[model samples]
Structure formats: C-alpha cells, structure tokens
Target: MQASNSPSLTRSQLATELGVSVFTLNQWAVSGKGPKAIRVGRQSVYRREDIDAYKATISSTESTPAPVSQPIGSYMMRLPEVLSLSGLSKSSIYAMSKAGEFPASVKLGSRAVGWPSHMVMQWLNDRMGNVA
Candidate 1:
C-alpha cells in the first residue's frame, strides 16, 4: 500500500531519504536503473508512493530484526546517480537512448550531458513491471 503521508521529493532529497550517496543516484539515472521520477518543466520530482514501494521491496528481502519507517520520497538525483542506480554501462545507456527505449540526456553545456532523473526512475519501474 502507498504511504499517505509521503510527499513528492526532489532528486537530492530522495537520495538522502534512501540513504544512498548522490553519486550512486546519478549512475542509476545515466544507466537507466532505479525508480521513476517526474519532470515539471526543468525540475524533477519523485513520487512518495514509488519510493515507499521500492523501500518495501528492498527492506523485505533483508534479514533484519525489524523494518524502520521510511519517508515515501525525499530525494532528487542527477544523471550520474541514475546511472549508478540502474547499473547500466555508459555504452548500454547510449544504446538504449539511441533506440529511444531509455530516457535521453540533454546537453547541459558544451561538454556536459544529463537526463531527467524522474524519467530514469520511470524506466526502471517499467522494467520491473515487465519482469513481474
């Protein structure tokens, strides 16, 4: 079930809530792994429900004394974080992008590139649904 108290979160906030380093989140985005995020124009946001679901899945698999209460969403990740989150290699991300199956990165500057963090998360969710 979704957490009613969970609130929309930015990539950085979600990363903190997940206890994952920002670097990790970026990898997930670039690699096309992790949870689905949303784009509000140039800003990115993650749904609290999605974060809670992901945490539940991960926490349930671990052999712990008890599960802790976690915020549904509270972080906002960058492209590098998504790449790490997804575990897809750079080439793989590029290939997926070329095929239009993965979220495409934008040219941030002359040499900088980035993807929508929320979109990367969505791709991950889609993959999970298909696998199930």
Candidate 2:
C-alpha cells in the first residue's frame, strides 16, 4: 500500500537526496544501520519524511573531528588518539599544549600535525607516577 500524502524514494533517489554514494546507502540498508528502509528483494525503498525524521534524530549529535580511527603503528598521534589515551578533553589538551604543560604536536604537513608517540607515552608514564 502507498501513502499518497507522503513522498517516497528508491535507493538511488534517496542517495542523491542525501548527497551520498548509492553504495553507502545500500550498505546501510544491508546492515540495518541507517535511515529506516523497506527491502523488497534487492530493492530498498524509503519515505522522504522518514529520512527527514532520521536526520532530526541525529541532528543533536556532537560532530567528532576527522581521523577518528588510529592508524596501526602510527608514529604520530592525532587529537582523537591523544584524547583516547590521555583521558583529556579537546579543550584541555589544547590549553595544556598551548601552555607548554603537555607534549607539543609536530608539523606533519601543511595542514596536519601530530604528537610523537614516544613523547605522548612518556607524558602518560610521567603523569601516572606524579599523580597522587
């Protein structure tokens, strides 16, 4: 049964509306991990209003910075990794780094910088020993 009042979308149509690749939408559907969808054989269908509702539900989530995953054997650590291993918030990390109280990050490229792994590890060990 179709609802005449609400607009609906095919997989490609919804992917275009969301500005994501069709494969991504398909993966989401297959994994049951994204906007609600109906699967009829290989085809997936979505309601425009449902997509909008899904967007609203996720609108309040905090946007984590890029490079959320740590690279294996990475010589340098990005902000996410530092926070995970150091138990410090973004603001505290930056404030301490600026104040020269924490290990400073090194320039990796024109727009990217990271902390040396050894230095961060040393800082962690030092912190553990010093804290009461």
Instruction: List, residue by residue over 1-132, the lDDT tens digit for candidate 1.
Output: 123355887788878777798788778777766667778898667788777787787778768577634346623455578679899888898899999989887677887787766677788999999999
lDDT of 1: 0.75
Off by over 4 Å in 1: 1-79
Please count the clashing residue pairs in each candidate, in the order shown. Answer: 39, 0
Q: Which candidate is the best by TM-score?
A: 2
Please, what is the whole-model Cα lDDT of each candidate in the order they appear? Answer: 0.75, 0.82
Task: Report the poorest 10 consecutive residues by lDDT, candidate 2.
Answer: 1-10
Kindly report which residue stretches of model 2 are placed more than 4 angstroms away from their true locations once superposed: 1-6, 62-120, 123-132
TM-score of each: 0.41, 0.48
Clashes of 2: 0
- Tell me the lDDT of candidate 2: 0.82
**Candidate 1 similarity to native, TM-score:** 0.41
